[model samples]
Target chain A: MNRNRWLLLPLLLTLLFGFSLSLGSVRIPFGQILTILAGGDATEPVWADIVWNFRLTKALTCLLAGGGLALAGLQMQTLFRNALAGPDVLGLSAGASLAVALIFMGQAAGIRLLYEPSPWTTALVASGGCFAVVVIMLAIAQRLRDNVSLLLVGMMISAAVSSFVGILQFVSKAEEMQIYIVWTFGSLGSLNWPEIAVLTATLAAGTFLAIRSAKALNAWLLGQHYAQSLGVPIKRSRMIIILSTCILTGGVTAFCGPIGFVGLAVPHLVKLLIRTSDHKILIPASMAGGAALMLFCDVLAQLPGSTQVLPINAVTALIGAPVVIWVILRHPRMLP
Target chain B: MSPDTPTIALQTHALSTGYNNPVLHLLENMSLTLHAGELVCLMGPNGVGKSTLMRTLAGLQRPLAGSVTLEGGPGMPPEHQVAVVLTEKIAGVNMTVYELVTFGRYPYLDWNMRLREEDKKIIGQAISQTRIHGFTHKKLYELSDGQLQLVMIARALAQDTAVILLDEPTAHLDLNNRVEIMKLLQRLARETGKAILVATHELDLALQTADILWVAGKDKTLLTGLPEDLVLQGTLDEIFQLKGYDLKTGQIYHTAFRNKTVALHGEGYLYRWTRNALERNGYNIAASTPTDVTLTIEPGDRPAWQLRRGTATNLYYSLGELLKALPK
Candidate 1:
């Protein structure tokens, strides 16, 4: 049964990739698509550019961002030993959103900008700000022994950052408001190759670190004291988890503007499907499951029948919220 | 016995265990040894450091000042020498008895883990030995308290350690289940040659089953010896701080009524037997009753004892005793 499931991952990935690439507003023939991807002759320049540059980049962005978010969520779940814990629960994405809003709305009037550079450079600054917030939250969680209090503090931090962004939106001019609103909706069509490279590298590093800590995570499931008796360095393991969560969450938010629900929902879906919490299996399963779910949502977002595209966050919440409600009602004991 | 007999399965040298700066000392400067193939009971009143001692022996808590050495015997690693079952419920309620039992193999398996044939056999034997083989596929939450206790013991058995420690394993069980659990432990000690240590408040049951007793008292001392020796030497009474007993009649009446006394008379084997029965029933067997008391009895071939204003007779003897005393 396990081997068959392992084999099914790549098959599902290929099918999702193929379906995502084929269904768009403009339909390109399979033969022509293949020729264009292979760097061969194209009947028209626009069709070739749309297939190679626009749609393909968007698909790859979904793959990277989805995998990164889900892996970060899984690590947070094990670290907190709470099923509801996720990347957004730590306020990292809210911090990035606030930083980007400050830059886009020209709210940094008094403070001199360090560097006037490209969009990627602005994203780097935002990622650094997000990581700072995550570090502060991690330190606070270490000091507070109670889980509920830690969750409340994270929510308060998120609300504080969100209120600051709301003020920025109120004062901004018309064009800046348009840009901020578009960024807030969240899309996979914005990144270029350089940003994609950075996202991929960060996700790979974070995933590797999480996988290496799988045995320690199993020991921790028994409880903190039992894990200590098993010779796990609790402080060091917690630091590694916090650092990995920051990298994956900060990287995805830097590129995709705080896409919701994929980080929170994909890990849960993978665990339900795989029936195991061992990260050796859960990490890769979450990576593939997250990518598939994101691509499926992306395909829905680009409603081929209509000219309008739904927001990615709206699609995720529409699918994620009902499953979350059902999970809570069915397994109330698993909430913590 | 040799001083260096090498039979000590666990030893503590001046150990102290407590939480947060060691202000509330649960255990203090305690030194003791648990030998192999012995059923040791740790008996104490509530809040007298029984659980704390078990946790320290299991290495779940660090001692404030001492070392616990697990002597490797019969070719097992020091890490595998001790297995503990705590009073707290296991966290994985969804896991089956089989899966939970297999978790004991965690300390032996490698990173890319798979249970070997020998591991499976050991787990199977543990399940059968704990009498949970019939419920091996059932989830933990579906079992009763006694059944769950057996599953926990089965998990500990699968660990294949030389020493087993349990902290109040029978605290939630009924009377029948408590005896069954203690009997299982005693059988395991004799049959498997594992040194079993359990902390419990069931003093009489411990006296029946345990070979040695580790008594923790409020005086901050730990006393260890054979259970009968501890009782015969009056060490158990000293630890409990009990007073007010009649030595000649072997009666323990209320401590507050020290000046109150009752007297009765009888002779021979039947007399001694009846006197012991009266003493156990809370009457001071003496030469005579007080003149102010009301007494009731029926006529018999021999003298009879009875409660005041009650119809019940308290004197009886076996046919053998009667025949032996008949006009010889």
Candidate 2:
């Protein structure tokens, strides 16, 4: 049964990845899709252009951001030893949101703004916000004795950063607010190759860090003291785990605009299918599962008959929240 | 230490330990050593620094001063050298018994957590050692409290350390479970040749199971000796006596006894309980049988107590009936 789950997860993920690529506003033929993917010429070159430039990039972004945020969430949940903990638990997304909000609403706040509304500039400011929160959290972690306290501190920082964003929204122009609000809705399609490369690099770094600390994460299941007794250097392992969480969470938030529910929901969702809490399996599984769920949600966000796409954030919550509820109901003791 | 002598598996030198947040110091300037194949129980009343000291020894908390070492090495030993079964509840972990036990092989396994042949053998032995093979596939949340405690001990056993420390392994368990856990710890210490230390509130259980008693003293020190010596010397009474209970005589203060002193003759477990029943009813036992009332015990499948009161003999089958027939 366990071996079957291992085989099934990737098979399901591949099918979703293919299905996500196929379903856009314009209906592309599956033959042409495969042909275009194989680097062959399509009957209409525009079909190849559409498949290469838009759908493929969007689908890959879904894969990277979804998987990254979900892995980040798993690290946080295990590190904090909390069921409700997610990538946003350490205020990374909130910090990125604040930075993006600041950049979008800067002119209305009587600040001189030089940047264009390009993905690069937006990503730059979002990254700035993410680092700012990381620095603040690392500083607080020094004085704090326990992870629970640090988690509480992260929540407080999130609250403070959120209030700043709320105030910025209140004074901003409708056009500026619209930009910020749309960013909050989250995006997967706007990124070109360069941004995706950076996202991939961040995902790679975070996944590496997570894998390096997989044993520590497993030992952490016995709680902090037991983990320490098992020869895990608590401070170092915790820092590595936190670093992974920050990079993965921040990278996704920076490029994709603070995607919701995926980070908070994906680990639980993956565990439901996999039936184990072992991080060695969970790390890769969650990444694949997160990617699949994101693709699935991105497909759901597009209106069935029209080009009008709902907010990616709304689609994830609508989809993620129920799946989590189902997971919890299926096993009342699912959370740790 | 030489191989001929018992190895000092764990030792602490002048260790002062406690929490730093509230600035409370628990144990002060204490030196203690634990030898291999010995199970020592640290006993004391509440807030007596037994847990703080255990935590200190387990290397969970930093000592205010001094150091704890395994063998002749400095600082704490690695996971392969020492294992600890803590009181922390493994709640909502979503791991099976086998998975949790496999955690004991953390130091042995690589980053991927794949077990070698020997590692698998060690884990199997640990499961059988703690006798939790029955539910190896069951999730932690599915097990009862006693069963979960056994799983935890099994995980520790899988560590295969020379030194093991358990903090209240019997806590939150029923009477049978309590004995089972303590007995398991004692057996593990002997069979594995490990130096095991237990911090517990179970004075009676500890007295029976521990090879040595480390009683927390009034001056923030450990009073270490054999269990019988500690009990006979009234060292065990000092702390528990504050609650008006005597550990030496196994009697409570303010238990008013009747002035009647009866001579009851008996032996073995039944005799002991029979004497207990008589004493509970305020009747005293005397060495001299020439006193007013002499009750002779008749031992059999169904034991009987014979009462000879000035040549008027009477017999009762049960202690309950005999006590009732006598005056209050």
- Poorest stretch of ten by lDDT in candidate 2 chain B: B248-257
Worst 10 residues of 1 chain A by lDDT: A108-117
Local accuracy by lDDT, each model: 0.75, 0.85
Using lDDT as the measure, the top candidate is 2
Q: Tell me how far the alpha carbon of residue B256 in candidate 2 is from the true structure, in angstroms, after superposition.
A: 4.1
What are the clashing pairs of model 2?
A: none
Per-residue C-alpha lDDT of model 1 across residues A1-336, encoded as one tens digit per residue: 843666676687778887787767788887787789899977987888888777788889889888888888877766666667788888888888877777777644443354443568667867986887977887887887544576678778999999988887777777766776777788888777777888889888888778777766665555554444444566677778777888888888888878888877887787666665456677788888888888989889987464578888889888888867766776575532
Interface Cα RMSD, each model:
3.3, 1.8
**Model 2 lDDT per residue over A103-174, tens place:** 889778997575677788888888888889888888777677688899988898889989998999899899
Tell me model 1's lDDT, rounded to 2 decimals: 0.75
Model 2 chain A: worst 10 consecutive residues (lDDT sum): A327-336
Best by TM-score: 2
Using Cα atoms, each model's DockQ against the true complex is 0.19, 0.64
Instruction: For each candidate, give its TM-score against the true structure.
Output: 0.77, 0.94
